[model samples]
Each structure stands twice: as structure tokens, then as C-alpha cells.
Target: MSDPTFSVRPLDEDTWPAFAQLVEANNGVWGGCWCMGFHVRLKGRTAAQNRAEKQERVREGRTHASLVLDGDQCLGWCQFGSPAELPEVKSRRLYEKGLTKLPEWRITCFFTGKGLRRRGVADAALGGALTEIAREGGGLVEGYPEETDDRAVSGSFLHTGPMAAFENHGFTRTRPISPHRWVVTRTVSPT
Candidate 1:
């Protein structure tokens, strides 16, 4: 088959169906996270709750993301928002301790179809997010990604995305959130 075309768009009201389909296609992404890993603490919660909460935020215009679309079909996404918007980070207590500076925006999670992994889907998603940030008058952008290593927790587990993806976008390792993960950032001011 020919290489699938790649592109991304901001997740808006019109694109909710595509985003919903993408998450539902993955069975709610990460045991039913519904891409709310950083939006809410998902412990002791059902997948239905996660899905509802995520959709609600989207409707309220509180959540943000860049959707990697293969021609109207969303195959991947990069979740981002202000620090206050995505307060429930994975290693919150730990990640916050080292957060000396609060970023204007934070890139919290990423999801790509199973078949799209090992390709550039996530990279495109990240690029799309940065583009959106620039459009919004670029400021400090933060992200959480685990350092590359031979670990059992790889693949879909790297929801925050790989460090290489961030580095490719000029993000630098700022602090260590855990033994494996880190808080990275890059400034994007207007031209």
C-alpha cells in the first residue's frame, strides 16, 4: 500500500467526532483514560467516567490538542493546555517539586494508532502542538517524557511521548520528575 498521508489539525468542536473515534478506537486509550491522564486523577475511576469527563472538558473548551489526521480520520493526537488546565499529571507531587517555573502551556499526553507507532505520527502531533502554541502567541511550553532506555515500560506506555520527539522540537530536559521521566521545556515567542 502507498504511504498514508500525514497531517494535523486543532481539536475543535467540529473535530470532536474524530477525536472521540480515535479514543474509542483504542478502547479509551490506556485502560480507558480517554486521554485524561493529566486532566484528572484517574485512580479508582471507571472508563465511562473517564470518557464522560474528557468529553465534557472538550465541550467546555477547557481541553486542547492537535489531532493527527489522515484525511478526516484522526489516527493520533498530542494533548496540551495551560498548566492549570492539566493539573493532574502522572507524577504530580514529584514533578511539581522540581518545577521552579510554571510554563504558560504544557504538553501532557500523546496517542497514535497501533499501526502508526514507530513512524512519525507522534512527531507530527508534537509539531502540530507547537504550531498551535505559536499561533496563540508562543510562550513557555512544557512537556513530560521519559528518558530513552531499555525498559519494560515502552510502546503505548509512553503516553507523554518520547524524549526524542520533544528534543526534535527543541525542548530541553529541565528537571527529573522520576527515575525515568523528566520535565522538558522550550520557549516559543512571537516572531
Candidate 2:
């Protein structure tokens, strides 16, 4: 099949609602996160509450990029920013095991609409991010892709990305922070 064409632009107030809907649709398996599981502390609340909390958090602050759209419809969401912008990631218990250094650009989250899975939307989104980063000509783009020995968790569960997907875009495994989490980096050179 031919690849679908879509554009990945920074999130704007105009597109945030569609992005939220896309995120909610994935919550059935992603567990009501709205892709906020990593960004905000859940504080032992229910998934619905966590979702509500994240929505509030989104309102209170600015995000680097939060919307991915195909024409007028939102198809995916990718949360990224400079390492300093993502203060919450610095305190995640999962990140403390072996991550002593910080990345230049942190890819904290991702979500694709229900109908758009297994499509090339993610690669397109990553490419768009790279284009923007390259244009700025600063910062190393980084990702935390899931690594799994368990067969059940290997598929679909690697929602952020699988090693192959990142590698496919020139990201290399810089370190294995945990058994199922990796520090992946790819330096972008502007053309």
C-alpha cells in the first residue's frame, strides 16, 4: 500500500481538542493516559482522574508540540521539548536506574488515533520533528523506546516506539536504563 501523507506541526490551541480525542481513543489499551502517564504523576488516582489531571496540566502550561494532524483531523500526538522543559521526567523512578546524563531533546510521549495505527503516521511525525530540530540546528534528538523480553509486551505495548522504529530513523540505543527501557539518541545534521 502507498504511504499516507500527513503534516506534523507544533500544537496550537486550535488543534488541541482533536489531539485530546485521539489520545482518549487510545486509552482503552494505553490505559486512560491521554499519553500523560510519563508527564504527570498519577498520585494513585483512577485512570479517569489521571486523564482529568493531565487535561488540567495541559491547560496550565505550554508544551513543545502536542498535535499531529492529517489535513484537518488530528491523527497523532507527540510530546517533546528540551530536556529542561520536561522537569517531570527528571524525577521518574524508572529513569533514575542508569540515566545520569540528560538528552538534548526528549520525546516524552506519543499517541495515534484509533483508525491510524500501523500506518506511517509515527515516522512522519518523527520526520517532522527532525525537520524542525534541524532547522534550528541545535540539540540532540532523543527517545526512550521500550525494550521487552516478554513476548506479550513486545507488540502494541511499545507505544512510544520499538527499537526498530527508532533505529529505522537513525536513532541508536545509547544505553539500556532498565530491562524494558532504553536511551536512544540520534544527532541531527542540518542539510
Candidate 3:
């Protein structure tokens, strides 16, 4: 899973097949999340319904992601969006309490294939997301990564990724939204 041959690419309609395959391999990511947890209004909707809604978003170019791929197969991805596109903050009150200014884009979640976990896939995905953000006229890019040393927590709980990855990409910790999650940010090279 630590293959250095993999490369990063932005998700688009053309690459949807590979992305769908990866999602299928992971069983919809976090038990049928379909990477829609942060984007949808999740009240009363079933997972299947949310998945369908997310699929529509992706089809409409509303959903954005940077994917780590081996050839045509997507191994992992980092989800990103404008604050308006994904306003479901993990600790909404805490985030609002510490809020200084809103970021232009947010790094919401990450998903790597089952066997691909711990293989630097999330790192690649975050990096890819940053690159794409820069390409689209860079702005403040925010991220939420857990700050924990406990391996007892299932990796599934780490969909936001680890703080080290954010730091590696020059994201500075701005505030702690929760005991386990921190809001980190970096400015992408803007045109």
C-alpha cells in the first residue's frame, strides 16, 4: 500500500468511474458515508438517500476532491469545498466561538481504501487538494485533523486525518474546536 508510484489527480466526471470503484471497495466510506456527511442536511434522510444526494452534487461539479490514484484506480481522496458548500462543522459552537474569519475553502474529510490505510494516501490526498485549490485561485484553506496519540481509536474516526499531515503541508493550528480536533489553515498560492 506504500507504493511510491501512485499519483494525485482532481476528481471530475471523467474520473468518476475510478472514484466509484474506490468508494465501492471501501463500502461507501465510513459505513456508506459516500463522503457526504459534511455537505448534506442530514436530518431524517437515510444513508442511501444521502449517498444519492452526494452523487448528484458530484455530477453537478458541486463536490470537489483530490484523489490519490494508482493508474486508473482511486486509492484515496481528500474532500474539499467552500465554507458555504460544507457548513457542517464538527464542533459548530466551538468553531463559531473561536472564529476569527471564515476560510475560502475547507478540507473536510479523507478516505483511503482498506488495505491502503497508513500508506501516505491521506497525505497525498491533502496535498492534491491544496494543489487544486491553488490552481483555482488560491485562498485560505482550512483543515480539521485529530490531535491524538491513542491508537485505540479506530482509524475510521480519523476521516479528518491526523494533525501531522496538516502540519507537513504548512497548515498552522489556529484553534482547538474540540479536545481532539483542531482547526488548522494555510494560504494557497493565489493567482
Cα lDDT computed for each candidate against the true fold: 0.85, 0.66, 0.86
What lDDT is reached at residue 181 by model 2? 73
Candidate 2: RMSD to truth: 3.6
Best by TM-score: 3
RMSD of each: 2.4, 3.6, 1.7
Ranking of predictions according to TM-score: 3, 1, 2
lDDT tens digits, residue span 1-191, model 3 = 24688889888877788888888777777677788888865667776876677778878999899989999879899999999899887888999998989999999998888887777898888888988998888999999999876656677778898888899899999999887899999999965
Compute the lDDT of residue 1 as modeled in candidate 1. 17
Which is better, 1 or 2, measured by TM-score?
1
What is candidate 1's local distance difference test score?
Answer: 0.85
Cα lDDT of model 1 by residue, 108-171, tens digit: 9989876767668888899889999898888999999977676667676688888888998899
Whichever of 1 and 3 has more lDDT, that candidate is 3
Better of 1 and 3 by TM-score: 3
- Steric clash pairs (candidate 2): none
Q: Candidate 2: which stretches are off by over 4 Å?
A: 1-4, 27-29, 45-61, 89-94, 135-137, 148-156, 189-191
Question: After aligning candidate 2 to the native by TM-score, how far in Å is the CA of 30 from where it should be?
Answer: 3.3
List the candidate numbers ranked by lDDT, top first.
Answer: 3, 1, 2
